[model samples]
Target: MQHAKLKRSLTVFPIVLFGLAYMAPTTVFSTYGVVAQITKGMVPAAYIIALMGMLFTAYSYGQMVKAYPVAGSAYTYTQKAFNSHIGFVVGWVILLDYLFLPMINGLLVSIYLNAYFPSVPFSIWLFAFLALITIVNVIGVKIAANVNVLLIACQFLIIIIFAFLSIKGLLHGMGSGTLFMSSPFVNGDIPISLVLAGSSILCLSFLGFDSVTTFSEETINPKKNIPKAIFLVALIGGGLFVLISYLSHLVYPNFQSFKDPDSAALEIAVYIGGNLFQSVFLAGYITGGLASGLASHASVSRLLYAMGRDGVLPKNIFGYIHPKFRTPTYNIILVSIFTLSALFVDLVTASSFINFGALVAFTFVNLSVISHYFIREKQRDGINTIKYLVLPLIGAGFTIWLWTNLDSKALFLGLGWLAIGMIMLLSITKMFRKQPPELSIDHAEVNEMQA
Candidate 1:
């Protein structure tokens, strides 16, 4: 029996919304205190640097999605642009995000729930969170997108509230006593190197912008809208991160003084809006976590299906789409199971693991652009030179810079995962004697569907 394909009902609006949801725009608060400390009270500055770097990579992603409008994200781009062996490794490395990200969301939410309800078991909260996203994804990505719309809207509403209260506090001479302050960007004697390090960690904030490409198959007009959505998602999401971090900085200038860096946002909420607003703020933070889990859960399932359909993984299980739902049923279930490991891991370690793969994927995607456009297609004309080579080269440079700045532990873990993937590649291709299995991505057929 033939497997049902992913349903094509998504427009660019929902696609961008899904990316924002995955990125969790409200996450600025969740990560604010940690990044604030890392950058020496320069979280906003770090975010600006991260946004610039991510925009370069986002440009490369837009270019790639235009060329290959399909389900696989960095995996498909790297495979088609270069050799299958290298692509398999890139896909495997990026697969770390697919495997661990959902769990990170789960772990984050469970912690919040456990805090709110001291009597409940963490496992219960985690299981319920996993079940909700899994069932939503299983029903359909359209439903997931719709759910994201609501969850993401809540996140934005909370942000607006926070911004309002922050502005009020600034007017009344609270923390910084001024809305416009340069202290968030520059402080006494803090090295630029620390802000760069903070930006490396903050790169995780822009994680899902490229993910919209994974929905190319489901999106209407994959080539046209997918590229547009990618740029829009990255720009909008990054802007939000920078803006929110700046506001939070202005509201509470002393980043180093939080009782618990992990729960610093809560303290800020209490400072600005008191306990009632604090409760509402916590609810919104949890909403953001749920939104990220739902979006990431849907994204990784499709990525797994892409790898599975390519026969790099067990095709029978991972590639099999649900007949009626037109979703990657098995892959969705598999992701939920892997997310169970969140119960065992800490948030910091889990977050570090994702950034390693994300930065590497960014680096390779930029390289893929050069390989596909500059070298393979010989698009060496005047403007094509800049479009194909220079821009992506800058993108690669930015990612490599971020890669080197990755936490030492994450670097070690990522390399270990890559080594294991290479070993698996050797086994799959009989010691590199043959090309690994590849997907038959039919752009022509997709265009026909578009027409």
Candidate 2:
């Protein structure tokens, strides 16, 4: 049986752009800034090392996505390559991860807005941002892609400007060379352990690379462009992050770091560009948020809609496509409700707790890629698979190492989400089992047909 391929509305550039813009520079910048402060300038080296480690895993994903271009991303790949239980878990975790992404963006927007407006309620900013993104997303995917491209341009422009200014400043004796003089092998005040823990926060900024794979079904050339886009997203995102971390230390080397990851970028903004610069940054920040929020909503809505068409989730709620718009209307509305609620709650308590979920999901994705490709390779008959096996294992190991090194708070949050997802999955499975066998098979067949 053959399934019709999805039309490619996304290009490599938009995929890369969305990855970079999804959580914005602040997500990684703020989260990892503490690590930099702790390392007392060694943060750049850490980023470089982390990037190197991630590349091997990135290749595995690139290859996997090419072989299996599906809407569910890792969920689909892992399930097909492995087992249904593993696939179910992957889908559950990734869905949870996706659900929390908008909240993180919303929280960051609220925080940044407060710095500028000071008097406005965080909830107001949060909802306003959400509403804006929702409207933009409802228009069409092309507009969202264009907005992502523009947002990416704005962010890259800022990063380039900052990198050059910082490098020039350093060369002219205006900034710190302390990290350059320091040895990577030696322990610093931030403590190697703390730095590793801090790296977990910063590492998420490095994620979204594989998010391109989620849209593989909609890509024009999934095999070539999806792989290329995955690699490009990781390479570009990693390089820019490393550059920014290095330049930030050189421009304003700080011994004491800000405790809150949420405020990290604001500190850098104040230090690097000052009040005037902050205004410009405010524009970039808001733009990035809108871009990311819209992209996430669109992508995840499609994911839900796909699942709905599968009967894994309630089909009625998500399967309603707008005839005029040809869009997943119910899924969009459902996502909007949850997103707005998260925004309101996050505004009150500043709960960007979703980052933890995202990182954990990322770690699993890397691990799953490694498991399916690396571990499974040697078991196959007479296939020359040394590169496949080693690279993937290393990637998996790196993911585990990073996951283990996460701060207790991060671990707690991640585990909590996972547990909740597990319970949800169990309920979902039980419900599915309770359905008549004929109906279950029929629905499953329908999903297969749609796929």
Candidate 3:
């Protein structure tokens, strides 16, 4: 089932768009609202700082991807940097995170659906959204990418429209302020603790960029294009988010009133454009969320195919690729089934089930970056070492700090989910009588690489 490389159909631009599309507008805009509250109005500044932090880690990822472009992104990087065991753990944690991301997006879409049609049950909305996308994912990757390209274009247009409207509103005194309300960079009694807290939350909106590497096998020019797409996606996505966060402050200066994390941006849209534009805004947001769900579905399915091909998972079940399409049809369907089931769980649990896995994944990702550098210092010397080692250490430390600050229920639930994933891993290993091997790609010893 394994191949030498991804098909040459997918270009860098489309894949980068996929990453950006994964961070849905509602997710991005609402995240800005939450960060606005936490930072006490230093919303954009916080994003800028976080962008700097993310850039350091991104550089390391860029190098890693360039050296070894493979489907199991973090798994390959961690294994190459550290060892197979740690790499397997990284792959496991990332898979756990990716599997639930679709459900999170679906549940979130349902929340927005409620605002539009109060009579519709959120559970129904969740299931319908999950099912539709799951089917699309199972159909094939090219079809899935085509869908994503359209969705990304739509979402990008919406954001552009939003920026135009918000800027016009600010210029015409329709908004609360022009420049930031306070000395945003200087002193506003902004707590360091709060910024740290908000940055962690903001990290969620930026999580999907790394998932691009899951397409390594499908990308046209894997080595050059993969790294290019990742850096550009992160750069563009992170930059736009910062701009939107700044724009959000102009539209909704009173961030204190936005205690409700979920609907914060919707409230801003309502306030900024009134009822007429709110409808349009919400429509765009829903589209963005759906796009995000679809992207998550596609990426995770590829990860499953990669794992299965390596004999770590149920090879027969997951390794079945469609000969005509060259797509992992069975893996996609299996992931869809799980995600669809998760839709129900998310609706009932209110989606706390999603964030915990993501946090755990982020924690390990940061740790992987740090450990990879320390282990490969001689090979990865100079600024690259500091960029890899130091930045990831900060990211990891900050993530842990935020993890501690999460609500008690979240903490408990996250731990419980981790335990469950561990159990699942144990069961799978025992069933197969073989553990997932560590991922490694020595640049010096490399021939052609495949996902």
Candidate 4:
């Protein structure tokens, strides 16, 4: 049977904007204190290290997207580059990243909202935002992309205003001497181990860029645009993260000064701009969370659709696309159901579980580049050895190192999730007697023709 294909309507600009929205530029504030505590006020250094590490993986993603422009992101790339079983397992691991993201974003939205409206229950805001994000995604990716443009614009505006306020406050309150302190970048006294440890958490801010790969099928000239979008998202998002952390560090140099580490950014906002700007800051922050939730919900639905269409999951439901909206309606609703868990889960626990799956998928994407170029193709197709081999090796190594440094809770939860995926894989492949199911490029071409 033929299936409807996603509309190839997104351009490089919209996709990059969507990626930025998914990364949520204002997130540095939400987790600022935690990273500050870990790095001993060297948050910018942690972001710089994390950005460098992610760039290697981003290059791998760009190469793979050129080779296989499909909807599954890492899952499709890995499966095509390697084998069906490994791809199936990677798809499961990616589920941990894509599926739980909306939940984490929703929890963040609720946390920030609850802080402002102390009387209202958190569950109300959680479900409300989830429902809104679900509806927007179900309508269409184009609409979601458009919404992201506006939301991201607001976020950037708020960030610019905040930066100005922060600099002004710093000069007036702490003098010009404090403006260029090395404490935010490094303190010769702090151990390298602490900076690396902080990077493990800061890496979370960079998670959404790879989600751009999932939009390959929907993006115009995806072979060129997708890779560009991936690199731009990583570089732009990373630069913003480092800058914001540096400015924030200048505003509050003492890492141990926050009464509540999680909400320290909010306190800093009030200190810089007073109560009025604090309200504006909260509005912009909440908008960032909304943008993140919307993009994540859309990504997970597309991923499930890709998996379902490949027969890795039940195709009848997940593989169904809306004729009117040109979207995976059922999968969108399914992600909404998963997001309701945010009502019960706190931000820390929900946030901790995501890093493992992301790191695993990132490591494999690097390996996928190596497997495709070096192992199978054997002809780097005129591509340099550095692009195909050395870079990916470094990327894999860096991600592996970060994976090993995951929080103890994250490590346990990630392993448990992987164990469950293994069991499911056994059932699907019939205990290794049969190959795991997949959709071929030829089959996808036929479906596109039919559509």
Candidate 5:
């Protein structure tokens, strides 16, 4: 029996919308208070720095997708650029980012819902979101993409309304005496160290753009469209983050005034537009979280399918795609099961689990570019040295810097996860006597190119 592959039905626009959904355009609001407290009102600057760092990494991803356009993303790139053993480990590490992020979003949605319906248990909301998102993913990627577009539109509408209200509030003497001020970008007294620390957390808001590469196999003209989608997602998402944060900061110049930093964005909403608009804002926030969960679920299932096909995981399950829907049914179910953990974990802990894995994957992706072009190819493709070397070096440096600033608990948990992956690698390689298995993609590539 022949197995169906993921269909290449997605274009640049739908995939870009998918990327924004995965990033959850409204996440900046959820994280704004924490970032504001850290940056001392320089939230925009922190995002600006984080955006620059992610763009460099995005460039590296663009280069890699051109060479190996597959669903494995960082896993496939690292393996082809380096070795299978290292690739296995990279795939294992990124599972933290892929598998757990939807759960984090679920937890966030539950919290928002519980705020309104105080009597309903959080577990009910969590499971409801998981079930809905899982079903959408299992149905088809194109359908999921359509759902994302609708949900993201709602989120963007809410953001635009909030921006207008914030501007009006500022004009009415709600802020630092004028609509324009340098405090949101910088302050003469605030230390640069504080802003860098804030950027570390804000970087989480930028995580979803890289996941766009996971759709490479299911994208039309993967080589060209995948790169364009990746860049557009980063630029557009980062611009939204910076603009919203700047406006929020203008309306409430003093970060110390927040009663609870975690829910500061909601407080800003109430201040700007009163109770009715607060309800609208919450609707947008919940919609953004759901959209994010749906996109993340789809991306993670594809990653698992890639690993399963390579025999890195149990091929019977994770590798299997539905003959009718052409989707990874088993992997989608598996991720849905994992998301149940959201009922037990709080938002902070769940959110912390992802940053370590993401930073590690990004750091290596940048290095992979250097290894492929600078060391292995010796710039033989006539690729500019600056493109292969200088830019990626800067990207690597910034990601590593952010990695160091991760909270202690995140570092410990991430290291523990890596240790488990190392043991699994040893067992899979049969004590290092044989190479880890990999799927043969030469035939598929030839067919795709010919078509």
Candidate 6:
């Protein structure tokens, strides 16, 4: 009997919306103070830099997804572009994020909830939120997408209100007393190095765009929609990040004045409106958490399903999709189980691993585009040179620069985690004597696809 395949129920819009939710649009507020401080109130400029970097890499992801429209994402692309062993390693490396990102989401939301309902145990908040996320994912992708759309809408609503109030406050002489200010995007006094530093930090905000590629199997016309969705998600997410930070800089020109850089958004909320707005802001934050958790939970589960279906991981548990629900049930549960680690793990430690795997995946995906198209196919004629080689080269350069700029703590921990993945890869391939199992696509779908 053939294995139950992932159902195709998505299009460009839903996946694009899901990617926005995964990026957690409201998160710009949370980190506003820190970024402003880093860039000397040039958060908008930093976001622009970050957006450019993501766009270059986003172009590469778009290209590769067109060639190989499968759920494996970076791992599949690298493997096919190169070899199974390298692909196995990339997939294993990506597991750092795919496995724990859901945990981070659950933990953060639980932290916020625990603060509101201090009487309730942190574990209780974690479990309740995780349960909701798990149940939604287990049900189906369409249902999960619908839930995220609601949550994403709520976040955007909060952001819109905050922006309107900030503008109102500016008109009434609350901040710089003027609307247009170039200082946020460029300051003669602030060094470019600091702006670049801030951009590196903001790049994390662009993380979820690539996660969209994991849904290729579920997307209608994977070749068309998947590539379109990847670029759109990155552009929308980056644009939102830039706009929010710019407006915020105008409203609160003094980045150094906040007592707590961490909760700076709360101060901005209360300043623009009042305690009422702050309360509304907190409620909206819950929606951000919900959106991020639901999206990440769904994405990681799909990655696991892809690897499991390929027999690189245990096929029975990770590969099996439900016949009725058409979801990867066991992998969903496993991701939820991994989320339990949130209770004990701190944010810093968990985040370190994610950046490493995320960067490696980004770097290799760019290389995969070049490896598959430029070198492998020798598509150097005319437009193919720019399409195959130049764009991905720029993309790879940006990711490599971003990799170099990783915080020492992140670099240390990321390299350590990568070492572990290498060891695992060696054992899986028996010391390079054999190839890792190749990813098997649903050929029925591939045959239907046009060349």
After the best TM-score superposition of candidate 3, give how far the Cα of residue 429 lies from its true spot, in angstroms.
6.2
Q: What is the TM-score of each candidate against the true structure?
A: 0.83, 0.76, 0.75, 0.83, 0.82, 0.80
Please report the TM-score between candidate 4 and the true structure: 0.83
- Per-residue lDDT over 322-367 for candidate 4, one digit per residue giving the tens place of the 0 to 100 score: 9998888999898999888887665555656787888888999999
Indicate the residue-level lDDT of 443 in model 3.
18
In model 1, what are the clashing residue pairs, if there are any?
none
Q: Note the Cα lDDT for every prediction shown.
A: 0.81, 0.62, 0.64, 0.80, 0.80, 0.78
Candidate 4: stretches off by over 4 Å? 1-18, 69-72, 121-124, 127-145, 175-177, 211-228, 298-346, 379-383, 439-451
**Which of 2 and 6 is the better model by TM-score?**
6
Q: Residue 181 CA error for candidate 6 (Å)? A: 1.6
Model 5, range 166-278, lDDT digits (tens) per residue? 99888888876477877678678989888887787777888768778778888999999998998899999999999899889888888899876766788888888999998
How many backbone clashes does every candidate have?
Answer: 0, 0, 2, 0, 0, 0
Instruction: Tally clashing residue pairs in candidate 5.
Output: 0
Residue pairs with clashing backbones, model 6: none
Residue-level lDDT of model 3, residues 1-451, one tens digit each, is 8667436678898888677765554457745555676678776776666566555455556666655666645556666666655555555655556677776777667777775677997778877896788667665534355765676677777678777778888888866758545545445477776676566556666666776776776787788888788778778878888788778777767778864545677777777777777788788788777766776677677666666676666778776788876767887677767766644452313233444455555556566666655665543567866666776777666556655655456567667656665666666567546665532322111112111
Report the error of model 2 at residue 427, Å. 4.5
Q: Which ten residues in a row have the lowest lDDT in candidate 3?
A: 442-451
What are the root-mean-square deviations of the candidates from the true structure over C-alphas? 4.9, 5.7, 5.8, 4.9, 5.1, 5.3
In candidate 2, which residue pairs get closer than 3 Å at backbone N, Cα or C atoms, i.e. clash?
none
Off by over 4 Å in 5: 1-18, 69-72, 118-124, 127-145, 211-229, 298-346, 380-383, 438-451
